[model samples]
Target: MLLLVHAALTFMLVGLILMVQWVHYPLFAQVGAATWPAYEREHQNRITFLVGPLMLAELLSAAWLTLHPPPALPSWSVWLGLVLTLLIWVSTALVQSPLHGRLSAAFDARLHRQLVVGNWFRTLVWLLRGGLCLWWLTLLL
Candidate 1:
């Protein structure tokens, strides 16, 4: 049940990131310079509300599962999952969050591009984590 919850959170992030990557972030450049700052701030606030809880739940659950994995799941896999979850947090705090901060101040073309490109790291990590979760869930069945 815990693993199912973890997988559900991870898959939700996977879908969210894919939409942000392909749809949301790309549209930033089109929002117009005059309104970009306010738009960027609103995006930060709204997205944080949606993404923040899911991330925290996934992170805590990943840590718990790492220490007490299902009998069918290998210890190393849970460890990897935890590490990947940590990477997502680290990347958010260190990279993506700062870029959002800069964009909120004023939209820079270079920074907008960086936000779009740098986001690929988190997107890909979630994709990998989602696949791993599905594979691990299969082992239980």
Candidate 2:
């Protein structure tokens, strides 16, 4: 049951991550500053609206998996997963949300630069998470 939940959460997060990276970020970059002002709220709404539940589900799944380990994930995998989770928190709190705030406030070149830099953290977080998911999945298989 825990493995099933963990796998489902990982798949869902991967889908969302890909959508944000491949679709939303590019669309956001292309939108001109004038147009971006209007779009910002909707963009923020879409992210928070989708992410909140997904985050909760992920947290729960992580907790469940930690409590009841699947054989595929050894002790090291758990530590790595925990580290990735912490990175997610740090990236969201320190990097992504602040960048989102700046970008949403006023669309400018500086804001764009910040966002682009901020994206690096996002990229790292996703990569780490993807690795963790694969690790867990490998354990399961």
Candidate 3:
């Protein structure tokens, strides 16, 4: 039951993360030309209103797994999962959040560069997550 719950939550978090990266981030990035200010305003709201709590839920789910631990799951896999989670957190703080903060101020060439560079973080994070998901499935099956 606990495993099922953890699996479900992890899947949910993955879906949300994918949407934010593929949909929200692209939209936010492109909006710089036509409706930069409006996009920036609403983007901030969306992050606060939507992504913030989802991220928290993901962290909480990870924490639950950590505390209880999963049976039959390798210790190395768990450590990798934990490190991936930390990488996401650190990437958000060091890359994404700072870009958003700058976006809130001014839209410029630098912002474009930042967004492009920052996106690598998102991409790498997603790739790591997908790898983790595969490993997770391997554990399950």
Highest TM-score among the candidates is held by which one?
1
Strongest candidate by lDDT: 1
Q: Per-residue lDDT for 1-141 in model 2, tens only? A: 766676677677767777776677766777887788778878888789988787777777776667767765786676666666667767788877887887777677766666666666666666677777876676666
lDDT of each: 0.94, 0.72, 0.68
Q: What's the lDDT of the predicted structure labeled candidate 1?
A: 0.94
Candidate 1: lDDT of 135?
A: 93
Q: Model 3 TM-score?
A: 0.77
**Winner on lDDT (2 vs 3):** 2
TM-scores of the candidates in the order shown: 0.98, 0.83, 0.77
lDDT for each residue of candidate 3 in 1-141, tens digit (9 for 90 to 100): 555654555566667667766676665555656678677777778767866776666667666666766777776766666677778888888877777777776667677576765766756665676667567767888
| Prediction RMSDs, each to the true structure | 0.6, 2.1, 2.6
Model 1: ten consecutive residues of lowest lDDT: 33-42
For residue 111, model 1's alpha carbon misses the true position, in angstroms, by 0.4
- Output the TM-score of candidate 2: 0.83
